[model samples]
Target chain A: MHGETAPPPTGPFADPALYTEITQFYAWHMALMDEGEPDAWADAYTEDAVFEEPGRTNVLRGREAIRASITKRTAELAAAGTVMRHWMSNLAVTPQPDGTLRATYYSLAMRAPRGERPDIFAHVVCRDALVREGERWLIRHRHVGIDALEK
Target chain B: MHGETAPPPTGPFADPALYTEITQFYAWHMALMDEGEPDAWADAYTEDAVFEEPGRTNVLRGREAIRASITKRTAELAAAGTVMRHWMSNLAVTPQPDGTLRATYYSLAMRAPRGERPDIFAHVVCRDALVREGERWLIRHRHVGIDALEK
Candidate 1:
């Protein structure tokens, strides 16, 4: 029972243009990360954003901390000569009453070592709360859960 | 890359009321299943609905088949006196160009014996294509994926 706290009926993303823009925002976020642009990736989040992985109990608050975490992971992969690609699909966007957007998407991470075939390294569902400051939509909170850990 | 085939900007669910209605539909669908109503659960899908679990390669087509599958599973659980609770969160709904709605959500299934503590049994992401035939939205195609299976 979700208990009556449904999202708002319509907000900024109700408009087609804004919806497309939000989608592109996610696309660009992924592109920037894949291109090793950590600074740009961190810029995608709000100054006080919160990133959490519930399964691992890993939480990073604020844009600077999030940036450092991603940078460190990307550097580790690069140093090991590993190629990583993140594929996201089944995205759904909803408008919140407080003028924020709630975006949920499925992500699959494929990793390969130099010349080896790519293999699925992780699969997760990401729930993101996004806000628009000025003309840009930034992530306010992101919660990720890894799937099928229990037998 | 999603490759140019993006979801429609607006459709029946573009209206706030309709969006809320569709969300309620899912709520009721889950409630019906939890209440051991197999016939009602089958009614949630269209006559020619397709239910697929891609990770397990399990596919059930048509309403009757889907119903039978649910009925069978429920019966087995009942026979063992086990209780199953499905918790869904981070739901996102998108309207399709052909008048269908694409609903994506994360599901965590918890199970336990009649008098024991519940434990998570499965975690999955569900992508469903919903259609409105006569003022009611029903699922036309559902694709489910379990996380982190491939390595």
Candidate 2:
């Protein structure tokens, strides 16, 4: 909840279409990431997007930077012969005056080794800012707060 | 994938408002359930709703039956001093000609014992049919398939 500095918009949010699109976007986005498609997964972000994971090192700026990180992670997971699934809960979307959207949700990064049951890798809260680009919405910013690491 | 008898509709889905409303519904629904609100949690279902979990015994029919189960589960979890969070993934919504909606999603039941780290309790796929009654959507039928119990 950004206070008076960036108070939320009051009027009714137009563009109900974004609700479906954004929600579906995430479902596809996470599915692709889990399926190990780095390029396609990172494509959901804008050219100048910012991705920050406070618990982890490095705050990646720009799509290429994010793509590189995704590529590295994909390779690491693949080499380990593991399956990772990202689960989301309590997704709330808010529309801003500048035609941007803020989406917040709880995420669980589940990890499953070959021939083993999946376990919780990380529990996190994600706050993402998205902009409409062409026919779809793209993430302009993402901040993930790790639940376990939180003080 | 139901074949023949209950084939999925192919054409574009009408009423995009439902996309936002139904997605938000689950967000609130799961939150209420996790917070141990039985009556409110069961209020999202129809009077004669059918709830089924193949791995678990008993196919509860009617809202009262579902409410009873929710109440019992809520008490049991509270008595054990545990916090249960349900996480969903890959949510897909389809609209039918009769104005009903079918939503399918992967769900993980995570259990946290007091301050301990959370663990996956059950991994499940839920196929639910929701119908509109006046102002809001209500669950008409829900069939949960447990991954671990699957043959």
Candidate 3:
């Protein structure tokens, strides 16, 4: 199951390997973010990546803009020194026959800034992604929704 | 890759394959719900599954109770003929050496009942799952937080 294409998978997806690859892609990306480099998190996406969060009319676009946004978040986290851990589940990876992959998953980020107990900061939106560019899959677009963002 | 557990490669996880299996498990489970089978959706979880919606203090537990709650929801959907689709992404799956999988993913579910413009229904809190059982993974526990829920 390494690099070689498998048989045609049934039920809306062709490649099962795509699912494994995209899932691994996310695991690696998030791990980088958790390592405290938000810039690396933002850089994991395409240069023209469009990032959106809930309750904000503005959609941050491009690598620089995305980096700026992440930098601001990192700054905030640095000030608070909160240990935030993101939890994700229920990922839906749908594969297109053309070898491209589209996936969605559910996530929760538990933010425990300082000495406070960890609280559920955001119920988030897991957006669809296009995975290509040889072996490495980068997120092309992302839109995050806040299910509940109350402090 | 269909059952090939070759020592479980390491990537911030002791059993990465469990993560993938659990992800697909939830995917297949939710897909059953989207296909209008809420009974199966409720049945997919364990007897002690937990479900919580933000802003409401009530928590749903147990298989029968969960089924009842889902049945109620299904009844509403049946009456409304609402078509719901959950998009999930950003899955980070970390497997403990013990084989229990801790995973997270972000999700967005849009509901379009009776042809109205699809509205973002829930920005959700997705938590890590404990996947047990030999090849198939089940959501042993699930905690949901609503960052935003459709009014």
Pick the TM-score winner. Answer: 2
Comparing to the true complex, what docking class would candidate 1 get?
Answer: incorrect
Is 2 or 3 the stronger prediction by TM-score?
2
For candidate 3, lDDT tens digit of each residue in A1-151? 1112422222443244666666577777777766688877886788887777757548888878888877787788777787777766666777667865667666667677667776655555477667577656777777775544444
Q: Is candidate 1 or candidate 2 better by TM-score?
A: 2
Task: Calculate each model's fnat, 2 decimals.
Answer: 0.00, 0.26, 0.16
| Pairs of residues at least 3 apart in sequence or in different chains that clash in candidate 2 | none
Candidate order (lDDT): 2, 1, 3
Candidates 2 and 3 compared by DockQ, better number: 2
The local lDDT score (0 to 100) that residue A56 gets in candidate 3 is 53
lDDT tens per residue, model 2, B1-151: 6778875666565466766666677876786787688877787788899999986959999989999999999999999887777778777788987989999888887776643566678899999999986656789999999886423
The number of the candidate with the highest DockQ is 2
Task: Please give, for residues A48-91, the per-residue lDDT of candidate 2 as tens digits.
Answer: 99999884759999999999999999999999999999977778
Q: Estimate, for each residue in A1-151, the C-alpha lDDT of model 1 and write its tens digit.
A: 1112523222222345555566678888987887788899999899999999875657999999999999998898888888877766545577887889888765656677777876656656689999989978899999986652322
Report how far off residue A115 is in candidate 3 (Å).
Answer: 3.1
Using lDDT as the measure, name the better of candidate 2 and candidate 3. Answer: 2
Off by over 4 Å in 1: A1-15, A148-151, B1-43, B47-65, B71-131, B134-151
lDDT of each: 0.73, 0.80, 0.66
